[model samples]
Target: MKEQSRRLGEDSIGSLMARLSIPAFIGMFVMGMYNIVDTIFVSYGVGPNGVAALSIAFPVQMILMAMAAMFGIGGASIISRSLGAGEQKTANTVFHQVIWLVIFSSLLIAILTFIFIDPLITMFGAPAEIHQMTKEFLEIILLGAVFQSFGMGMNNIVRSEGNAKTAMLTMIISAVINMILNPIFIMGLDMGVRGSALATLIAQAIGAAWLLFYFLSGKSTLSLKGFGLRIDVKLGLRIIAIGFPSFIMMASGSVVTIAVNWMLQIYGGTMAIAAFGVANRIASFAIMPINGVTQGMQPIVGFNYGSKQFGRVSHSVKLGMLVATILSLIAFAVAEIFPAELARIFSSDPVLIAESEEALRIMLLAAPTIGFQIVCGGLYQALGKARISFIISLMRQIICLVPLLLILPNFFGLSGVWYAFPIADFLAFSVCVVILSTTWRKVFRETEMVR
Candidate 1:
């Protein structure tokens, strides 16, 4: 067995988690920071409209990311398990398949996006004032879709092999490049929102190049030399099946965003959408550490479960949930205490800041429950239980939130839109508790049998 794979099955859960998660936490946090920084620069450079344009353009970006997540995440699950089971060949094959799949899918999406840029932007609920800017920003961003997809997809593969530091370095490098370039392009060059898009494109391209080098230089546990690049139909199908839940989660998020944007348009106009855009960014940033924990937990759970180390699997899950809850509580406190201060980081406009503060506090009202819900969904995914994971993924956005979003505004006005978030979060948390409790014993009973 390779050293990395063995470490995953043997390492102390607490120390291993810290080793893996801390890098992922730092990387995801910095990666998220660039987005925040991008917004800050745009908010200052071109004003509230620029920030609103980003919000409108965000759903389409989510669609592109959904494709990457589907392949990356799905492939990572297989690779980690295959490694644990001593199937190196299978891991290499999946890696190559992910590469080809990401390239093909991203290119296809980008071309289609370019062709339908105008109507697509409008469909995302872009108001008249920001529609043109949204279109321009998206156009430049699409130019680098393949780069973004490659980097995102391969980063998962790197982590699956237990090279968390490499994965971390990839994001850190990209984010640093992006932050340095954002001000120069947006303010110095006077390029506005388009410049923000351009800087992101360059950073993604560099990140992709770094991953490509890592694989080609024989640094990865999965080698490229002996593997045929042909896609195995059955294996590819499995990858898609496993990853479909992640795809659904993200794609549904895009749908939810579009729905929310339309609702905001109806009730609160352009400024409300801008506020949502900012507040959403802040919320996403706060949740990054939880995401990092889940990412760290995935490989450990997959490896141990594959090797039938059920005790470690249970331990990892419990520890992950505990840590995630702590992080979420911190986020909740921060959002409650300093909504306006957080809002001010993006824009100085009194109206926009005030709107953002209200939205942030309201939307994150169930913040304490968020970590549990997120980790539960991720746990199922790591276990390769796609069906259960898919159901869990659906509960928050499609089942609970969407219905609330559609029904609430009629009775409560714009505030209804904000209320939908926390309500869904709490409901999802309730369901997760029930599911985890019912299934917990059955999942680990086999461990007792083995003993």
Candidate 2:
């Protein structure tokens, strides 16, 4: 098992991808399932409004996740390279400092959220019924914000330190807790939406504690050694810089979700909102396997780029693209074929199932391209091209997307809002092709210089 982690740098490109992607797929698949399980329970136990309320809360949840990705992806990129260069001490310092960042940030967010939960809910365009549900769920989950914040932020560090299995274990174990507690609390105790939120918070708290204990233990290679509470400005800056891409990517998602929910409320009503929620959740599962592939490739890309193995880095990029495209095509078919079954899995509510099928079919029209966009953007981050990744992220959500989201719905009404996603994704993939062409030119240039 230890031997698997050891060959990151020495392995052939094909072998490296397989070794990294398999664990990443399982871990990330489980990560997606974490919410999916909740969506099912909420849909069954609480009904379509419950699912809609959960959907409304997603943008806020994403905001916290954005912060985690900032520190997690940013710091991990540097740490992987540092480890590859045999600078274990520096890696340890970065890890400890990251822990401080995650805790402090979560505390600040929780205070602000608690102060204005109602106002924030209104801003997200929640109707009276959905607003009540959203408020209850957000309040419970926000109380334990630090657990999720630090857990997700630190999980990447464990993986970068050659502990992918441990990093994966964090989610796997949490998934179990979430799975068991959801049924007991929701049905056995009759807690409804609040019960679902409570179950998630409890599970995430355990994950956070697990990540913290692992670094403190002697068994880990990157133990936190008395890293002073003071933040190092230089280290902090680099972490932020490397992490900017991931922050932008997740932040854009939050923005898109808010925009969609607001529009659905304005033009489509509660039924439309429910439909959007189900369709989006299904799309999330489809896109994530490809994300897993990119995630596994990130450390490899960083390690090779750090070691100046330019050819190896290029090979990994191509491999990611191929895997992502193939997987996306397959998932597209599955979602399209089983739309009713998928909707039914989440909710038996007749109105939501009828309407959600519209949203699902519309959004998935260009689903195969999720593979192209994910692979393109993921490679940019893996190669330490943060700005490129940020722009690619924006292209789908902000630049091409928000405009179409606003304009299209006005002309075509409710269906128009859902249609905008696939259009924006297709356009972004074209731009990605151009950017990647330019990026490859630079890669070979640097490779020649090293030679």
Using TM-score, give the best candidate's number.
Answer: 1
lDDT, residue 255, model 2:
83
Candidate 2, residues 266-331, lDDT tens digits: the string is 898887887888888888988878987887788888877777777777788889888998998888
Which residue pairs overlap in candidate 1's backbone?
none
TM-score of each: 0.98, 0.96
RMSD of 2: 1.9
Every candidate's lDDT:
0.91, 0.82
Q: Give RMSD (Å) of candidate 1 vs. truth.
A: 1.4
Q: At residue 439, what lDDT does model 2 achieve?
A: 73
Lowest summed lDDT across 10 adjacent residues in model 1 is found at 442-451
Residue-wise C-alpha lDDT for candidate 1, range 92-182, written one tens digit per residue: 8899899888999999999999999999989999999999999889999999999999998999889898889989999999999999999
The best candidate by lDDT is: 1
Model 1 scores what on Cα lDDT? 0.91
